[model samples]
Target chain A: MVDQPLAVAARSLFYRKKRHRDLRQRFIEVLLFLAALSSVLTTIAIMVLLVTESLPLFEKVSIIEFITGRDWAPLFDPPRYGILPLICGTFVTSMVALFVAIPMGTIAAMYLSEFAAPKLREVAKPVLEILAGIPTVVYGYFALLFVTPVLQMLYSPFGEKLSEWLPDIFPYELEGFNMLGPGIVMGIMITPTISSISEDAMRAVPVELREGSYATGATRFQTAWKVVFPAAISGIIASYILGISRAVGETMIVAVAAGLQPTLTLNPLRPAATITTYIVQVSLGDTPHGTIGYQTIFAAGLTLVLLTLFFNVIGYFLSRRFRETY
Target chain B: MQGSLAGVRGNIQRRQLWSAIFAIVGLLVLFIAIIVLLALILQLAIQGVPRLSWAFFTSFPSSKAEEAGILSALVGTALVMLVTAFTAIPIGIASGIYLEEYARKNWIAALIEINVTNLAGVPSIVYGLLAMGLFKSALQLGESVLTAGLTLALLILPVVIVTTREALRAIPSGLREAAYALGASKWQMVWDHILPYASGSILTGIIIGLSRAIGETAPLITIGALTFISFLPPSPFKSDFPFLSFDWVRSPFTVMPIQMFNWVSRPEPEFQLNAAAAGVILVALTLLMNGLAIYLRYRFRKGVKW
Candidate 1:
């Protein structure tokens, strides 16, 4: 009877411990689920805040006008709340930045993935990452000081006499602070992003494919250009979209280098404000929270958020479309 | 016919020569990237190093560029980073664990996975906008260090989560199976075996994310963190009876990047030099964080076989 009691006690203890562990596991699982859910919540919050704050602006101002009209002077006596100038600025600078980044980044990726020795690759990767790690503000400084000065030297002469040769096509003088300066610096800042991602995509191309090209009497250049390039095109396009998204959302470089003057212009060598820089410009001054000036920035923020999201979604789909190939 | 064969052989040799030439050209292209990086460093160093006096680190920002210092901004940055790390690390690692370990291949798990990846690429300024509306206006936190820190936490959370998932994914599934066979529960298996193994790289990810936060300016600006603060917030540690204080969290603050940005905008040459000096300090801080992360990752790679 005593032996029976002792055995029962030991059995009960085991059951209790098992129950405790199961309960603890459930508790931790809940905690982790909440943690993971927080990220989804963050995205929802962003969309919600942007929509709520910007709805007021769209309600007061015509959405079509906001999208298509010419000026961005929300604080003027008459208040022209047109965002076309900001859109033009965003597009002009991003296109220019992409122009510099795409070719340079792709070439660097080709060298890194196909040509460089392993030792060289190792040494070079951190250097490029360091380039990537540099604060955009530093690039902004570089844009204003070094790049603007150099551009002044090279373009100053042409800028002065350009009207004589290409009337209505060129500015008579390019300001020290202009779209080209920030656009070029932004390109350099994003180069590492493009190169690293492209290198990954190119590296994923199978060794058999490269070897097969060589077996067919293809030169190294021929194999890289004809075979590998086509195979990696999807990945390349995805990275390009991501790069363009970066250029679009970049704030510091453009805000610091390009003068925060919201003007509608096609010229790259002119001071213009992008959507991101406009937000910074307003925040720099003391616009009361409830005022039209303050709310206009939210409208701008919504535009920027939507624009970048569109690019992000596109890049995501492009990468997914080609993933099965790998 | 022999002469034709000789011609074909000579063509092969010439093709090989040109292939070698193409490779050399590729190297030359890479050199251009290097030149860009070097030029940035050379310019910053030339402008900044000359202005790195003791006063630059000690004094508060002044109207006169000659007397301006980054002391208050540096303190604000450190304070913000501490709060950011405290909030981001736990949530990120927990989510990483959940996604990689606990969750089944169901829709919810996939949703969080996609959400994290998307959030990582969502521009940092968007995070700021969200923080502005939600934290500053709705919750009424205003432009305090607390709000900035929390905003930064959200900004870097995706980075932390993605990197943490990567680190945990590297741990062999065999380890999980081994723990399960030992009668360990799923959470127990994760806490005991997986976490300890992946901690090094998890730490590396956190450090890297924090480094990015330190250099970020756009979001903080949107939240209305001041560009000029002459005095430091009350110390995080109290000099009086209650030893540790969070009064600093609610205080007005400016960070190094904002201070640097403000000075860089001034028309004076002196302000440009001050901005460069501040830039050097900010870069040094980021590089230190990154170097630590790199070192930790190296150690982790060396220590782990799989």
Candidate 2:
């Protein structure tokens, strides 16, 4: 009887330990699964709402008209559905931003990574990153107040000289608020993003490469450009593409500095509108939530989302393809 | 042969010159960033320093222009942030802890990791839409500060998880083994030995993530934060408190950005100046939070060892 009681107690203890272990494992698994699920729910719910609202706009306006129309007068009585002007404006502004950001940002990264002393790199890197941490609204104010005035001064004097060279084709009015001003400000805003990521890529290149180049009597500059820079080319390219995406997605600076005209002219000095700016415009209006006018905001959002998604996909694949092979 | 060697040296020198040019260009980029920061700070001080007074922080929004104050918005923002931090940090840190310490090498874990990486890149407006459906439609939380906080929490979960994993990874596995060897259980080893050592890293990451969450305007706007709340909620969870009631949940609440947007969009040039002043305050707050987080991170990295 004593042996039976002892055996029964042992069995109970064994079962309890097994159950506790199983419970702990299950608990952790459940928590992680919930975390992952939260992300999916977020992505799916956004798509659904955007689609539901945008469907009404599609019903009233043809998809072709939305894509190919030259004018955007959504606030006017006869609301036009042409999205081309906004799309062109977005692309031109973003391209200008890219042109300004890439060379400057790449050089900055190179200087910090290859040229600057350790103390300088440490000091400069964080200060540059602090630019990124500044709020977009502040940048918007800077663009509206400072950048516009500076550009206006350049255009006022230069515009007359250029017009004299070609009177027939160049009848220019240098607007203080135009794509040029916003593009310049956007370029500055995106510089930190490009420099930080590119610097990380450059720093990842092994010191052995630098040492080997130097053994052949290569200068510090020579080793950085021919050997180290080429090695990190893919990452550098990826950073620039990421910068392009950011420039395109940027909202506040463009909305504030760029003039609110949806004209489809190719000129950089003209006041232009972007998709994000259009979304802000409609959202701020008195349009009812369920109306077609309101739905256009979702359509604009969908376009922005799709464009960013495409760019991110390309960037993801390229970066993954080169994943720090060192 | 000596002439050819000289030619090769000339080629090398040209390359070096180009490299110097590139380096100068890089320095130019950093210079532009610095110049912009300086210009913004100077502009803000020149314009906003005179206008910033007790009345600006304490008064209520008014159509009469001069009577405007951000008191209610400030309180509302604080309440939303505290609630957001309270709800988000626990779950975010827990999920991070599980993935870093407990999850074994398996497909399930890999799937979770990939999902989280992608989630961090999704747009904030999308998160807003999601909050509208989940909390507003399904859970019936409505468009209150609680819903807004939860939405922002969800938006930043991936960031928190990623940072926490990095922090945990920084801790060597030897410490975990040492805890187990002392006859500590798995949970005890983690809670006692691992968490304390990594607390500084986790706190720094959390503060950084929280700062980002605080400045986010998209998700909050989507969750339907009222653009104007005249009174504070009587209780934290009550429909209304200090100035407004919970009934305002269904109404549009204005945040700093939304308010700034309102002011700037007007044709009145005075509003643009007001926008600049408001922007200075907002920038100051964000920078302070960010600076603190960065300092904490630097301290943690320098002083601590695995």
Candidate 3:
């Protein structure tokens, strides 16, 4: 009878410990789940904040006019809210940036993944990372101070001669704060992003493919371009899309170097304002809590978010879809 | 037969020439990119070196460019980073753990993954806008160090999460199996085995995230950080019983990038020099952090083998 009582007491003690451990485990899991949920909450908060703030602006200005209008002077008398000018500026800068980035990034990826020796690759990778790590504000300074001066010095004389020859086409002089400088700097900034991603994709291509091409007497360049490039095209495309998204959303370079005027022009020689630049311009001023001037930034923000979201979604899918199993 | 042989030789020669040309072209392109980077750093150093003295670091901003300093801005950056490190570390690591260790492979997990990816692509300026509405207006936090820190914390949360998950994922499944074989609970297994192994990598990610946050300008500007703050936030240390105070978090602040932006925007060459000096400091700090992270990662990798 004494042995039975001791056995029962030990069993009860074991059960209690197990229950206690389970409770603690459950509590920790709940805390971790809440931590995970914070990201979703942040996303929801962003959407809600943008939408709610933008709704009142929409009530004041029709969505059609907001989208299709050519004027964007929201602070002037009878404020104009057309976003086309900002969009055009963003388009021009991004186009210029892409023109530089796509070719350079692809070539760099080819060199790094296929051609460079291991030691060279190691050195080159960090160089690219340093380029990537430089702050946009520093780039802004470089764009404004160095690149612009060089462009002006080189292009001014030639531009004057060309404009005299073809008055209708060539600009007389590249302005001090033209889009080209910032665009070029932005291109340099984005090169690492594209090259690194595309390099990863190229490296993922099976070595057998390279060997097969070499066996047929293909050179390294030929093998890389013809075989590996096509195989990694999806990832390369995804990188380009991401680059475009970055260029579209870039702020400090355009804000500091590209002039604040929102002129709806396609010429790279002219200074203009992008969506991001305009937001910074307004924010720098003490525009009060609830005004059309203030609300315009949110509208622009919504447009920016949508534009990047579109490219990001496409990129996300393209990368997932074309990821090679081998 | 002679003619056919000659044609084949020409073809081979042309192909070889093209290959040689491409190899040179690729090398040249890489050289140009590196040259540009070197030129940027060189330009900053040449202009800013003379301006980087003790007085520049210790004094406050002045109407005269020669006398202006970055004391308040540096202090603000430190305080804001303090808040950011505290808030982001625990939450980001916990979320990463949940995703990698606990969550079932279901819709919710997939949604979180996609959301994180999308969040990474959202423009930094948009995050600023979010802070303006949610933090400054809705929550009425004002343009304080606390708000800026939280804003940056959110900005880097995705990066931290991704890196944490990557670190955790790199731990071999054999370890997990061994822990479970020992009758360890899921939390016990993660807390004991997985975390210690992954701590170095997680730390590297945190440092990198902080570096990125430090150089950020657009988001901070959008949240309305001042271009000129002549005063510092309240001391984080108190002479009272508790000995620590958070009043600094709610104080107005400025950061290195903003100060640099302010000086760069000025029309005077003197102000531009100040801007360059600030740029040199900011870039140096960022490079230092990244270097430390790289060293930690290399050391950790060398120590661990599956």
Candidate 4:
């Protein structure tokens, strides 16, 4: 009977300790759950902040005018609130960036994933990563000081000569703060992003597929371009979308190099204000709260968010689809 | 048969020539990217190296370009990073742990995953707007160090969480099974086994995230970081009782990039030199951090067998 009581007491003590551990486990789990939830909360917070702040501005100015109007002057008497010019600037620069990035990024990805020796790949990968790691602000500095001067020098004479032949298209010369310099620099900034992701997608293709192509007596380039590229098309497209989203959302490069004049021009040689540059210009000034000037940023922000969100969602889904396919 | 063989040989030769051309083109593109990086560093060094001096580190902004220093900006960046590191590290690690360990394959986990991926794609400037509305206006934090720190923390949270989860996932499953076999609870298994094994990689992720955060000028600019601040915030130390103080977090700040921006935008050529000098320091700091992270990752990868 004494042995039975001792056994029961020891068992009860063990159970109590286990119970305490269980309670602590639950508490810690809950804390972690809340931590994970915070990201969703941040998304919610951003949405709520943008919508609530933008509603007041929308009430004063119609959404159609904000999206479709060509003028963006909100500080002057009878201030206009058209955002089309900013959109045009964003589009032109991003298009220029894409023109440079796509070919360079794709070729680089092909070389890295298909042709480069393992030793060379190891060295090159980190160098590319370092390119991505360099600050956009430095790129901005390069765009304004170095790239612009070079472009102006190269284009000044060329534009002059070309205008003699085609006055309509080549009338304007490259300005000090034109879209081309920042656009080209932004292309350089975004190349690593596109190449790295596309390389990953290419690398994920089955090795047997490459071997099969080689067995057919195909050259490395032929196999890479015909087989691997097609196989990784979805992922490559995803990278392009992501790169486009990044270029659209890029701020400092345009703000520092591309002038803040909101001109609706397709000319890469002209200076214009992008949506991001406009936001930066306005934010740099002291526009009092609740005023149309201050709220304009929120309106601009909402547009930026929606535009990026559209691309990001597509890119995310396409990337996920690619992962599933392979 | 001889003619057909000749045609086949010619076709193969053409294919080989095209392949050779593409290989050279690809190599050229790769070199161009590398050359761009080298050129940036070279340009910054040539322009900024002459401006680096003992006086440059201790002085504040002045009307004369030669008289200005980065003391206030440096202090501001350090304090803001301090705040960002403390706030981001714990929360990011915890969230990563939760998603990797505890969460079931359900809607909540799916939602959080999607949110993180999308947030990573959101532009940095938008984060600044969020901070302006939520922190500066709604919470009345104004344009203070705390507000800037919090904004960056939110911005980098997704990076940290993604890296932590990746590190945790890389730990061999045998370790988890062994812990469970030892009658350890789930939390104990993670704490005792998974985390220690993944610490090196997690730390590397933290450094990289911080390095990116350090170079960020857009979000801070959007949050209304000052272009010129002649004085430093209150120090976080005191000689009296309770020697620690957080009064500095509420103080207005100007970071290195913002200072560089202010100088870069100036009309004078002298200010451009000052901006270039600041750029050198900023780039050096970011490169140092990223280099350290890369080295740590390489070392840990080589050291850990499993």
Candidate 5:
């Protein structure tokens, strides 16, 4: 008789627990769905805000002029809205940054993935992470205080010597805050990004492939450069694109090291303002929102957003394809 | 016959030399990066270490470099991080759990997955603009710690979500099946099983996300956080019984990066030293967070390996 009562009690308790579980699960699932949806909502908001802010600027400045004109004089007396110089500046610095980033990054990635023993990699990774984790503002100060002065000391003499021969072309007059200093520092800033990504790509190359190359009597370098590089081409390209995207969007380094002069010069030895730096420069002055000055930053941000997003999409797809194989 | 043999030997020797050279070059690349890192640390240490003191942590910033301290900026940064974690952790884990477990293998899930990836790549400043429009202009929250924190929470949302999903995926599905078969609800299974297992990694991700947010300057700048706040935000608690207040949330704020940025731009060399000191503090904070994350990842990884 006691056993019967205990069994009945257990049955009732189980039923009640089941009922509570049902309601909790339903509430939690719906909450999670809303949370997940927020990401998409963020994207939509970014696009909508950029478009609404940028639209007014386009109405003021002709789209063709903004794209095609070789000058960017937003704060001038006449207020020329030509963004070509900013675009040119962005390209010039990014090109310089990539020049340093790609070669060094690829080589480092090769060393890390293919050559370094596991112990060495463990030691090296956190060091590289420290570099990667440095705030951009710190990099800005480094560029301004350290890199610029060093470059000036090393290059100004070369400029004076070269002026004897090629006058205009050889005489690369490096300024205190120029495209070169920030570009090089930015390269150092992003090297870990490229190196790590490419390292991942190289790591993903099956060990079998490397052994196969070794079986063919290939040198370590040859095996890595020829076989593993080809195998991970998609990922390497994606990493390059992402690195470029990051370099393009990088703001504070150029703002502090490369002066806020939007110039159409390809000479990285000279000061040139990138789109990001220009935005920072304007934002520093506190241009009231809704003014053309304020809206210009949003426009620049939109341009930056579009440019980075394009590469991000391409990089994403490329990496995805690579991931799908594994 | 002798000449032909010599030519072949020479070619092989040249290839070996080139291979050796390439390996050296690769090592040199890593060396250069290490050197740069050292130079930056040395630079900060030379200028900043002398100024690290109790006063530096206690006083508000001032025009005089000696009088200036990072107290306001430090408090603001801490509060901002707290807010960011509070907003991001729950929502991000929920989103990640939904995507990983609750959502079906359908287009909606795929869309959310892809969108998260894209959102991760969006520039921080664009998020700032969104915050400016949404929080400042539309909602009339004005420039406050809450606005900056919320902006960063949104910015790091993708990172947290991605990390959470990965952590959850690391768990074996056998546990889930056993729980369900035992008549446990989905929430109960997740609460009792999945979360405990994933909590280490989830915490690691949150720390890393906050570390990144702490160092972030552009978004906060874009949202109109002043570089010159001498007073602290209103206290989060008061003398009265309630002991909780939102006054700090409503007040203007400055963060470490913004304060550092302001100092670095000043004309005086003394201010530059102050900037360096603040930079060191910021760097220490970020490095500590990252180190904790790395340690957690390492410890939990070995323990969880089945």
Candidate 6:
């Protein structure tokens, strides 16, 4: 009878331990839920704050004027909040980035998936990602010191040719800091992002498809172009859209390489200010908090956010519409 | 029949030739990408080697800004990074586990997954505002290291969560079933079996997250980390150390990016050179962390790939 009582006590203790563990798990679950929810909540709050603060900007500067007006004298006594100059600059750089990133990224992904041997694939993928690993600040330095100098050197020989050609072919002054420098650097920055994703997408295509084409004696190029790439098109486009989102959001490189003068010009060679560059400029210069100058940055930030968000939506849609393999 | 066979052979030759051309073009793209990276490395190494000094590593920021070294910035960066990792890793891993192994496939779980994806894509500067509003002003943490670290934690949380989930998913179902058949409890199986299998992957994810957090500049600037700080942080809890201690919530500290940015924007030649030096440091740290993550990922793939 004494032994039975001790056994019962031990059984009760075990049950209590289970209950305690269950409670602790529930607590952990709640905390995880809260942490995840906080991210969403934080995003919502930022949107609200941006909208509320940006309202004054819209009120002061009409949407059309903000979007289309060419002058960028926001710091003058009578501030000009014509945002088009910045928008144009941002677009020019982003478009140039796309031009450089897309063909190269897609081609590299195709090569890695369809052409490279297994060992080479393993080596090349990580080497390509080194571009992603390099900090944006370094890319900025490369653009300013190396790329700018190289461009200047290349142009120096063409100076007389350009001077001869200016009236007929060129209509603007040549500047050291221009879209060509930053666009090329930004392209390099975005290349790895596109390649990594596109490579994944290409790899997702069933080997059977490639085998089918090869069985028909289709050349590897024909098999890749007519069969594999088309099948991988959706993923490839999604990768390109992702690259665009990255290009739009890039800050440091553009701020450094693209001079922060919001000029209204279509010329890629002339100095211009991107939206990110503008934010960097306004934030760094002497601008008191709660002032219109500070508010301008928020407005500019809102534009950048909305533009990127729109691209993200497009990217998500493309991924859903085009996703072939799981 | 002989003539037809000859034609067929010619067609095969043409196809092989085209494949060769495509292969060459692909290799060319790879070459260009690699060359750009090599160029960046060489440029940084050549410019930054001379600036690498004991004084550069140990001295504080100077009033003659061009003369300033990066000691305090490095310390402040380390403190912020350590604190951010401490806060973010546990929560991120747990949530990842829950989503991967535990959570029911319900609407709520699906919503959580979507939210995390969108959060990953959200620009980082938004997180800075969140820190400014939630940690800095509302919670009264102020523009200090702690707040900045917390803010960065939030920014990197989605990345960590996604990566950790992928890692957990890679653990085979047989392991789970075997543990359960042996009468191991759910928590016991996860703690003992699943986590060990997933640890390499999880570590890789965390390191990648750390790299992203360290390079982040926008949120730190938004949350009020100073562009300059002369003194090193005393401790994690020192209020005077900005984000380090709870005691000095209002003090300012400069991070590597902001400091480099300040120098780069200056018109002085010396500052520009120093910016190059700082860029080298920042790039080195980022690349090292990323290399570790990539290596870990390769290990995971090699060990686990079917």
Task: List model 4 lDDT by residue over B1-306, tens digit each.
Answer: 347988899989999999999999988998999998998898899999899999999999999999999999999999999999999999999999999999999999999998998899899999998999989999999999999999999999999999999999999999999999999999999999999999999999999999999989898988899978999899899999899998999999999989988898888999999989999999899889988998899899999997
Pairs in clash, predicted candidate 6: B144-B243, B145-B242, B145-B243, B146-B243, B236-B244, B237-B245, B238-B245, B239-B247, B239-B248, B240-B248
Per-prediction DockQ: 0.71, 0.47, 0.80, 0.83, 0.68, 0.51
Give the share of true interchain contacts found in each model.
0.70, 0.38, 0.73, 0.74, 0.65, 0.43
Q: Give the Cα-based TM-score of candidate 3 against the true structure.
A: 0.97
Ranking by lDDT: 3, 4, 1, 5, 6, 2
Question: Which candidate comes out best when scored by DockQ?
Answer: 4
lDDT of 2 by residue, B1-306 (tens): 346988888887887787678667667767777887899889877766665789988876666556666776676667667667877788788778878887789987787787776666665665665675567767888767678777778877887888888888899999999998996767778789888888888887787777777667655655556655676655435444465345433333456765665566667776666666677777788788778877888888889854
Give lDDT tens digits, candidate 2, residues A1-326.
76998999999998898789779867766875576556556667677777887898898889999888887886578889899999988998898788878877887888889999899887897787677777666677787778878776665575554455566776776576788778887888788789888888899999999999999988888788888888887788788877877788777777777877787977777888888777655544454456665677778877877888798788878877766566
**Model 5 deviation from native, Cα RMSD in Å:** 2.7
| Tens digit of per-residue lDDT, candidate 3, span A1-326 | 76998999999999999999999999999999999999999999989888888889999889999999999898899789999999999999999999989899999999999999999997898788778888899999999999999887776465554556567777465888899999999999999999999999899999999999999988888999999998898889889998999999999999989999999999998999999999999999875678776789999999999999888878778877876666
Candidate 4's TM-score reads 0.97
Better candidate number, 2 or 5, judged by lDDT: 5
Q: What is the lDDT of candidate 5?
A: 0.86
Give the range where candidate 4 chain B is weakest over 10 consecutive residues by summed lDDT.
B1-10
Better candidate number, 5 or 6, judged by lDDT:
5
Q: Candidate 1, A122: how far from true, in Å?
A: 0.3
Across residues A71-178, which tens digit of lDDT does each residue of candidate 1 receive?
889988888988999989999999989988898888888888888889999877777777878888988999999998888777647555454556677646778889
How does model 4 score on DockQ? 0.83
Q: What lDDT score belongs to each candidate, Candidate 1 first?
A: 0.87, 0.75, 0.91, 0.91, 0.86, 0.80
Backbone clash numbers for all candidates listed: 0, 27, 0, 0, 0, 10
**Candidate 5: docking tier:** medium
In order, what is each prediction's RMSD in angstroms?
2.3, 3.6, 1.8, 1.7, 2.7, 3.3
> Candidate 3's residue-wise lDDT over B102-207, tens digit each?
9999999898988888888889999999999988988999999999999999999998999999999999999999999999999999999999999999999999
Candidate 1 positional error at B157, Å: 0.8
